[model samples]
Target: MSGLDIDRAAATQMAQKYRNAAEDLESALGGLPASVDGGIASGVLADIVSTLAQNAADLAVLSRVMGGVIDATVSDATATDDSVSESFGGLTLPGEEAAP
Candidate 1:
């Protein structure tokens, strides 16, 4: 069976990057209005802006979700490693003396 071998440091860093991107997108896109007033071709501009904003919002949400998943996966992997290590700590290897 294939085993999981997650690099916690790298995974955590990637998760942080995703979180930062989400924050950046939300901050930048949240200022846009669905419709701007008193400008030529404002209707067309508004429609474009509206679509961009929706897509940005969706992407930001997905980024946040991905970050959360990575964080959770790292946490679970670490827990499993610790558990396995603890379980193995009591065992004596071949040709090795047991602890007194």
Candidate 2:
């Protein structure tokens, strides 16, 4: 973990929490009755529930995408860190102390 940038990991964890919430909401939606009470307003209720389910799905997808972005960002950062270390490894400027 030395010299590692943790912001991307934190973002990935946040996105995972949102993904969990979306899954929970979708699970709850699955248990809803087709028609509560009589048939009146059932269609509207169903449509609302459907829209909510779709929104949850969208949120899950978005969270996943954010996680991917975080992973990519972390990977890029690691690569840059490696490149910088290699470029400066064992190199000393004039009048500067060399790292042991």
Candidate 3:
């Protein structure tokens, strides 16, 4: 399917998967102890936690954006321009022609 196509079921499923993974990371990070061993080990743990937190945030944003992508676009039949498909990496949905 085209990226811009409204595959609601697949989108919902993917969003749910992303959310679950983000939530799992969040829980793991939250449950981590305040400190590891000493010096380098502590720094390493801090870095790992930071990275995980960032990934979780990114995934959450992606999940929301996936759903929002469907909401933010005009239906192909009603759209007056090729701008939408062009915006999505130039991938036109089935039955849409690239503007001349």
Candidate 4:
């Protein structure tokens, strides 16, 4: 009902779409061998690999977007009376802090 709710819904839809796309790509790849009578040509295989890689990249972006949306929604829900720092614990870079 709210803007945050809308964003969460949209993110969920986008994630589902990306999952569908990935499944379709996998199915297409599975069918490739059947489509080619003999073994797949080197050039054709290279092209297929390139396309698959791009699809994978898209999936990654979609996943990241979904995660960001969830994070935003959570932050918004918890941020009414708190500072951003408090709402999100604390920011720390991967290698900036030593492991405990």
Instruction: Give the alpha-carbon lDDT of every model.
Output: 0.91, 0.73, 0.62, 0.60
Q: Which residues of candidate 4, in runs, are more than 4 Å off?
A: 1-40, 81-100
User: Can you write out model 3's per-residue Cα lDDT over 1-100, one digit (the tens) per residue?
Assistant: 3444456566556656756665665676577666666576888888887776777767766766664554444334236345645567656689999755
Index of the highest-lDDT prediction? 1
TM-score of each: 0.86, 0.68, 0.43, 0.41
* TM-score-sorted candidate list, best first: 1, 2, 3, 4
lDDT of 2 at 36: 52
The C-alpha RMSD in Å for every predicted model, in order, reads 2.0, 4.6, 10.3, 13.6
| Candidate 1: Cα lDDT at 10 | 99
Off by over 4 Å in 3: 1-4, 39-100
Q: What lDDT score is found at residue 62 in candidate 2?
A: 77
Kindly give the number of clashing pairs for every candidate: 0, 0, 0, 0
Off by over 4 Å in 2: 1-12, 18-38, 96-100
Best candidate (score: TM-score): 1
Candidate 1 has a TM-score of: 0.86
